[model samples]
Target: MPVDQIPIGTFSRITHLSQKALRLYDERGLLVPAARDICTGYRYYTFAQVERGIRIRHLLWLGFGLSEVEAILEARERGDAGTIREHFARRLAETEREIGRLHAIAEVLRTQDPLNGGFRMSITEPVIKDIPATRALSRRERGVYQEAIPRMIGEICAYVYPADGRQPAAKVTGPIMFICHDEEYRETDADIEVALPIAGSVNLDGTAIGVVTLPAGRFASVLHTGPYPGVGKAYERLFAYMNEHRLVPAGPSRELYLNDPAEVPEDELLTEVQFPVEDLPLSP
Candidate 1:
């Protein structure tokens, strides 16, 4: 009833925050009422609290949780710009990851077949073969799944094959292979290695590239002939085959690029997906 205090209804209208939310915030000690009527138990807010309420609403709209808003407000009260900047940077990165996940979900929906109640792509049996060990030059980088593989491959090729009439120092032995080190699907910071088998040793002292030798082993592999996004279907079949046959994986999985994306359409791109397998256990 005091002239200085505004009732909860009027405060909610002014701040654009629902009355229920204000009560919850008060209960959580995020924003306490400026005054409370002892007899009637009515909540009231002072004019000064109007700015704080509006700031909380704006932060909520910006996708910040109540705890995050509290931290930011506390930082602001302490005049700590560095903490505020750090919080904003972290929120930005989280938003980016969420966006990436949403995009991946959209891709799955677009590829699904409603009529058959299954995915549109079909997975075939993989060929089993023994692979020989080889030495190669490799470049490892942490990046997102789709964009990193092609970009790293281009960088390696540019280093090995220069356009200026200079002879190449190293001889490329076989198709480029991508070794996936992540145990599961990751939208960001996925560990990937791009390797090119080289016939001779090449100096990589000053660059990010290094020399690596791939161990010879038996592998189960399938030819994935389509866009990269749909290659998961091939992996599904390959893993299912391994599980059904009681074959255990021995090393990191690899993808041999049989054709260049720049030279062919996405649907025509060929990739040989290979998983190194341990030998079947001797019969008990």
Candidate 2:
């Protein structure tokens, strides 16, 4: 029993670290005891180790892993500022990512509320409208529905607003539209076309965008005002109208984004969901 060595009990009381934790730290070589009685096999700590004990507890409280705490302690002992900074920087980034993930989860939970969720019944009535034919700069791709649509829109904007103040190649006449060519519901690998009508003379000489002349047709249309997920109700209404009026789909359906999503909140987004249709003859 050295005069400098304090029993584990006394050390635990002074440092506020549990005896079990002190023993675990000793086993991990994170903070070894100052001495051990050979006869009793009891551990004792020195006052010099108290600061390190408090530091280890504080680091653990900050959510640092045991391994990370050990590395940080060693770096502090070496007076290596850069190593300490690197560890903190990494932890900060991890915290930010965790925050973002939690926010996404919260949003999902919020949208599940029956009365206040993101969904709403269709407020606008379905109508049969004549959609005029027009030439559009379009890009077709196989991917997730409208997930990659923004990227396609950016590609078109880049050519229209062409790089570095160069003369514009085309004039955008209408809002962005996404055409769904699939006949049935699909989870992935969907056939889609993203297009923007252009009325003025245009040149897509070197651009990957191909010119598409959107066909004129009578479409059953419904304007949906809310998040894209709420558009399902519009489709529900459209199909019901079709069934009641004995109308059949003539061509693929399309979504016309009437306003810039970036400029409006999710609840204010305006999208016209349309399906080309033909009237069924009266049964004799």
Candidate 3:
């Protein structure tokens, strides 16, 4: 062994990086060892690599992905603070979003916890009816359906009921309407529009808030009672009804919240699932 060469064990201990991690970095060429025994294939590091090993540890501790850490190290080598700053900024934004998502999850667990007994779902027979036109203040966004629904609901309500003691711009007429504009189910990046039915006129005051008129349509609607997680079963039943009746969905599906989730327990929450449908053509 060379006098200056440090064995993998000593290197791992000195840098506080595991031998497994050191091997990964070597394979990734992020922190390759100084030398290796040709016959035994054992990795050896030098004192010069101690600084880089510590840097890698620090970067990993800071939550940088392996690839991002490599980029950061390369940027640092070229004195490219801008690149480092960009990575930092992007990571900062992602961390903020994750924090918000966690907060939302906590709120759900506190208010609408359905995990106690796995909220039992009860669905009623589907009914075909004509839906009337109504005015609503809506927020349409693209995101994960589950996470975005509650967050956007709060966002829209905040505007109507400002924190400061100010008069509400519009009167809430009915439960919120959640419309999914996608033909297929999506875990993320699905188009979601949440509309709050309002009777009184709303003064937008040049804001981005949208006032939409829900067009009249024929829809197959069903009543679902239980937690939102089990609401998919209700959807399945509704679609089965449509299939039996030879009806095809003509537009996006919607869910009208029949009860305030904040006030009701998850097992007792009510939601009306509706899907616009049209009759199939007769065979010639």
Candidate 4:
């Protein structure tokens, strides 16, 4: 055979694809032979087919089945660049999201501080501010930490409006840290509430629950990026900052979720960690 011409066997050898797979590709119109021998019905591949064969093999290595590879290659052949671009873009977005979720889970696993091996004091600065009173058509439940939040958020959205529409104006509270106000039991029994904060004159159940007056108080706030489990470290950092500045929390720490978990990237979660503070330097 000429250097420019390659037999199917030669192509298969070079591409590390089985001859059977090459035949399947040809049958599927994925990679057809450049020329066919009239006398023997043999298929002769060109040097160009070698590249396509290699690409098929590569896609297979990446865990794409033959059918998906054919769809992608066919899109390219039809000169539909948009379809190909969209395919890769969607894959990229999915991979990024998976990576973010993995990071978040890992952070959750490694949350225990090696030095202390227990919860310790965390504090921050004092800044006077106002948090408007709001009501939530809220639901409370006790369940697994990871699963409870997302489901409740969904329920709140459902109660407010259509699930298919854009999210209504709202704020998610943190202090996501839950405690047993009644008793200390296993982690499973912890009281968890997902509150949706909304503006004035809100009717959750056609009447006011009560005006939750968020007192005007000083607070030290920090931005925590990534998933909830990763927040322990950020909280630790905040505690260090507070202690270094000689500040004490005047009230319970408040977590204001700045990003929605449903849409925001897991690793890029924006959580504002606000600790009510008493001793903060007065601005000049």
Q: CA lDDT of 47 in candidate 1?
A: 96
Cα lDDT listed for each candidate: 0.85, 0.84, 0.87, 0.63
RMSD (CA, Å), each prediction: 4.6, 9.8, 4.6, 14.5
Worst-scoring 10-residue span by lDDT in model 4 = 174-183
Q: TM-score for every candidate vs. truth?
A: 0.68, 0.60, 0.75, 0.43
- Cα displacement (Å) at residue 194, model 1: 4.9
Q: Which tens-of-lDDT digit does each residue in 1-284 have in candidate 1?
A: 67989999999999999999999999998889999999998899999999999999988888999999999999999999999999899788677767866775676577666753333444457889899998998989898765677678887887788778577758998899899998877888999999999987576666778888898999999987766667777887898889888898888899999888789965577878999997569799
* Model 4 lDDT per residue over 104-213, tens place: 55655556445533222232343335444434444556764455556666666565564668554344332232212223333555565555555545445542222243
lDDT, residue 40, model 2: 90
Task: State which candidate has the highest lDDT.
Answer: 3
Error in Å for residue 150 of model 2: 2.0
Off by over 4 Å in 4: 1-144, 164-186, 206-213, 280-284
Which ranges in model 3 have alpha carbons more than 4 Å from their true place? 2-4, 9-24, 36-42, 47-65, 68-117
Candidate 4 residue 265 C-alpha distance from true site, Å: 2.7
Clashing pairs in 2: none
Q: Backbone clashes per model, in order?
A: 0, 0, 0, 2
Candidate 2 regions exceeding 4 Å error are 1-105, 111-117, 120-122, 281-284
